[model samples]
Target: MAEGLRTAYQLEEDDIATILPEEEDKFNGEEFNKQFLQFDRDRIQKINQKGKEKFEQGYSKAKKEVLDQLETEARERFGVEDDELRGIDLIDHIVEINSKKSKADPTKLTEEQIKSHPSVIKLLNEKEKSFKTREEELKTEYDTKLNNFQKERTFSAVEKKALAIFDKMNPVLSSDPERAANQKSILINDLKGLDYQEDGDTYIPLQEGKRLEDPHGNGVSFEKLVQSRAARYFDFKKAEERDTPPAGGGDGGATGFPKTEAEYAKIVNDQNIPLEERLEIKKKWNEAKSQS
Candidate 1:
């Protein structure tokens, strides 16, 4: 029975072997599984590397196509072409060409050509306008300087004439330089309100508005006005009176009582007399006159 059982199991094994092919003795199932997994990994890695290379090539081609399109558009629009220049460089070149054309000489062109070039006409018009403006400015400057010079000359002439009138009116002023200067200044100020009439090449001082008359009811001359006004402001005496010695003082020219009109005049005209003594002398003169 054991022998028969062994034979039956062998037959079953033979039948299984026929259905499933047996591997060679050197083939290991575990090792073959490992090798198959490694091969799949290497294949996937190669596919990924090929895909990356294709993507890089596509990107480079797209970038070159875009740059070429831009250059074509720029050249067509600007009417300029250069293989070495692209984008902004092409634009700058076009601007330089147009600038040169704008600056072209109108003198070398025909009338019709010059009229057609409006930029040249505009530049010439602007230059002409600038020249006219400069001319107007120079004229204005010259007129202003001439006006100022005329004003100065007129003022100097007026002052010189005023000083001469003042000197003639007051002989005291001629000897005293400081007093002469002061009186001339005052006379000039008074004359500032007067009008001036053109007299030959010079001007004559004429009174304006309300005219002033002297005590004799006659129109006052400039000289008479200066003399009267000076007398009003200053106490002027004859030069001889100022130099003469006082009388009746025991040979010392000291002030004393006055007996006559000349003695009284001398005492009063003497500036060296004390104010109190002068007052006393005046009181004595009044008393003597009353008693008579």
Candidate 2:
């Protein structure tokens, strides 16, 4: 009976194997599998998105700390913001006023100069051109501000000790404020990345780059030690502006753009120009006329 049962089971398996793949009565297995894979993929995608958001939030906070300081400096020292004053024209006005009045520093500005500066008056007169030009400069400044991706881990004890050691190794760095700042920046990056071992009275670094293996070690991570050196994204944007020829090509020439209202009027009325280019010129002329 057992042998007969075994033979019957074997024959059933053989019959199942003999059945055509197309005829198999699968319980929506292909659909279920596809859905299962897609579900996990969607979850992973969401997780990645969340991670990016978290990183951006942290970075933004750090950058805001840096920016708030600059804004405070601008507001308290410069007195720049008002109803009419805005953008680089305002800054230029401030700078010019500061330059004329102050003895020590030339950048400290006051609110009164916003209206009085010759450059400021000129900017207000040519608002459109100045607005467009300064807007481009602002874009360049914003692009350069894209740094601080992964911030350094700094401890007071480490910094104090590092500074002591750093001054001994390089004593001539702090002759001027700018050189001192650059020196400090370079030293802090190097000191933070070192893993140290004590020898009686002195601290000695294990290596230049690697952190100590022990969990209890007093070493900063290699990444935390160095300042990020990312290249400016879209640096070519401002460079492109510098590379651009002056309006109507350096020397006096036909810029293919009508400079005067009379020129625009003549070009728009002329039938010799192509219909598309003429239409463009007419539309531009009408817009310029309205603005004027």
The number of the candidate with the highest lDDT is: 1
> All models: lDDT?
0.53, 0.46
Worst 10 residues of 1 by lDDT: 1-10
Cα lDDT tens digits for candidate 1, 1-292: 1232235223244433433234333334476446544543564476557755765565555555555665665566656657788644654455455556679543455556544445434434554565556556655655676566445446555655655554444244433445545655665676566655445644644555445566786766555655665565444456454433245432212345665898886765453454445556666677778988
TM-score of 2: 0.22
TM-score against native, each model: 0.33, 0.22
State model 2's lDDT.
0.46
Off by over 4 Å in 2: 1-34, 53-65, 79-90, 102-292
Q: What's the distance in Å from true for residue 206, model 1?
A: 8.9
lDDT for model 1 comes to 0.53
